[model samples]
Target: MKTSLIKLTLPLAAAGLLAACAGGPQPPDWQLEAKGSMDRSVAAYMEGNSRVEMAELERARTQLTRSGRADLLATAELLHCATRVASLVVDEPCTGFEKLRPDATEAQRAYADYLQGKVQPQGIPLLPESQRAAAAGNAGALQGIADPLSKLVAAGVMLQTGKASPEVITQAIDTSSAQGWRRPLLAWLGVQLRRAEQGGDTQAADRLRRRIELTQGISAAARPLTPVTKP
Candidate 1:
């Protein structure tokens, strides 16, 4: 996915691109570095590379700090939080972004609200192209998003908003699976597993359990090996 993809959700992630568009000069090195780190961070997180995600995110944050732009840093933090939400890790608020929200742009604030499922009708147009449809209560528009990650994030936002349908869940699962995004694939599978158990569909529950286990195994195997230390 392009680094600019996140800009669809919020204006902060593409500070470099915005600068370049305003004139003919290339973006400063700091902006390019920050944007690249931010892009890699999200991609790493989606692929379940927790170590790389945190490292890249910190690198982005450091670069943004060097630019003395609190709002840009806030945007980076919000993007991290939003990525977590997309993977179904919804237990936390975007405290990091909130701390610096005063410096954020109106569009950035709107996106923060949208991710929390509290976005107003006026803010619909400010959201990412994929999320705008869901924010407007038009879940059907999710189908029109060509990017799998974008579609999954929109569906995840729908879940947070209590507007998710069975089809939305299935679509999220299929999208994550297609992208080999193990983090979200496992998360959506867990959702299905819970529903199967609650509905007393023993067969379906068992299948989901096995699938989850298999996915977990793949994730474990894919992790970088740690060298053994001599005792």
Candidate 2:
């Protein structure tokens, strides 16, 4: 009887060990790599480096696909679409936004809604009540997000809807500029400048234009050097 009991206990212990080994960590290496690439892409976008941003995004897509992280992949695809919109690539229509899975996190969903509204402000009337509510709420909630890109999108949405004062948007842009996020800083300033012009606020428009010019100079100075040919 003792020998039989020992045999049963040893098999159970071995099976438990096998289970532990198979389970491994929660997020595997590919998931981590994909997330890391996504982060890098966002950072690049903030810094006004579109080339690097697109390249890093591609890496993230590949890694996420390999890891079977479908949710994150969908989020990345949405981000790619947002970047294209930000870059004003009007020639190519943004696709795949409608196909994003519904299981995305709240933050992801909010960001996507903000992007959609930005791309098609007229379509806001067609959105579900819940989506409109989320977009409105995210205008304030997204300010607290750690990622600069998310904060910028939130600010943009608020600015478009007249929910955020120009001062608030200016403050957000200033904060990003202080952190060296030149691309987004310039973009937001341009939006404000245009609004001021349309509103006939000459003083505000001039101030914004000067700010835009200064930021453009800084961005040009910070750009990576290209090979020069001797004539």
Candidate 3:
């Protein structure tokens, strides 16, 4: 589901490449490079590859900077923040995008608000297609999003709105698991594990615990360790 504000605004891989092949006017070099880098950055972040995520983000920033389009840069930052929100990292104030807010279009501002749980009725039309119905309080609309990441982001928004039902949580977990996005998979599993424990469903809790342990083990082994010293 290429449903983010950036995705709505940008041409994607197959179509853009085909256009180039057909000798049609292609997207500007900076646009293509920025979009690709940003997409990789989001995917790497979802997969818990922080090193690659930051590297690709920097590449995106470089390309966007070359274009001198602050709005586009702001869109990139919002995309990064939105992915974090979807992964349950909900504390972001989107300062990077906020710094460039004056240059952002109405749709960009609406998306920024949407990520922050400030969805307004007037802003609904401006939001990405996959999220519009969800923003309007229809959780079923999430199921309509074919893209896993888009559904997750929409679910995150529903969570903020006090509407993340059990089914939504399950879908989020399934999507994260299917995508091999360990970060969100762990986050959603933790949510389910807590619920299972609270409900005294020992069987479910045990199963979730083992899954969490397996996922964490894989992530820990792939991640580099940093030592800390006490003063």
Candidate 4:
């Protein structure tokens, strides 16, 4: 039930693609088979699609939301996958961030494996390489790895899915900082965290406070850039 905060602010997939999911209603399958197909389709659609019909995408979104699958990912991940589909379409060679997603489910694992197998011609589910994952592995673990996304996804899927404990979110922000990926995303997460706290999650608020502290540290290390280029 992990959802990435990336889903709420960004399209997850590039704008054109997810909207394309807006087609006529899809055929039904046994719940298991259908869930699998939907997941694959979402991944595939993300691999190579530019435009998505909003209506179709919304329908697909509904389908996923209502599905009875376990370890079901957050809507944000679907959107993220949709963007990947668009990317694969644009640059099939781009296996950019696939490796960072180790927790992605089996078929998703297969797809990553397939991409690597093309080179080795081997069959085990090999993970796509991502410097980000390496970095995460090296850094101190972050507690709330999927706080924003997971909680949101759960809230949508189940009635009692509560906001992440602030402590958890704070740890994730700290981890993200220690590993990089900070930038504006961290700043944004900060605001959202604050709002979330005011909405009755003081823990989320505290994390946001720590995030602000981390961002300040990062800002200090950065040097102002001049237009001049080194020869």
C-alpha lDDT values of all predictions: 0.76, 0.53, 0.76, 0.34
Ranked by TM-score, the better of candidates 1 and 4 is 1
- Residue 218 Cα positional deviation in candidate 4, in Å, after optimal superposition: 4.9
Which tens-of-lDDT digit does each residue in 57-78 have in candidate 1?
9998898898787767877887
| Per-residue accuracy of model 3 over 121-153 as CA lDDT, tens digit each | 999998878889889989597778987777888
Which 10 successive residues of model 2 have the least lDDT summed?
1-10
Writing each residue's lDDT as its tens digit, candidate 4 over 82-111 gives 333211221333232353345555444443
Angstrom error at residue 168, model 4: 1.7
**Runs with alpha carbons beyond 4 Å of true place in candidate 2:** 1-26, 81-99, 102-111, 118-134, 137-147, 221-231
User: Which of 2 and 3 is ahead in TM-score?
Assistant: 3
Model 4: CA > 4 A from native: 1-106, 109-163, 183-231
User: Which runs of model 3 end up more than 4 angstroms from their true locations?
Assistant: 1-24, 224-231
Error of 2 at 54 (Å): 1.0
Query: What's the TM-score of every candidate structure?
Result: 0.85, 0.62, 0.85, 0.24
Residue-level lDDT tens digits of model 2 in 1-231: 001111111121222211323465555566556556766776676667878878988897788567454455665666565543333222343454455546544444444555655524444444333334425544444444444444454454555455656665665567567667666666667666777777899999788778777776765546632211110
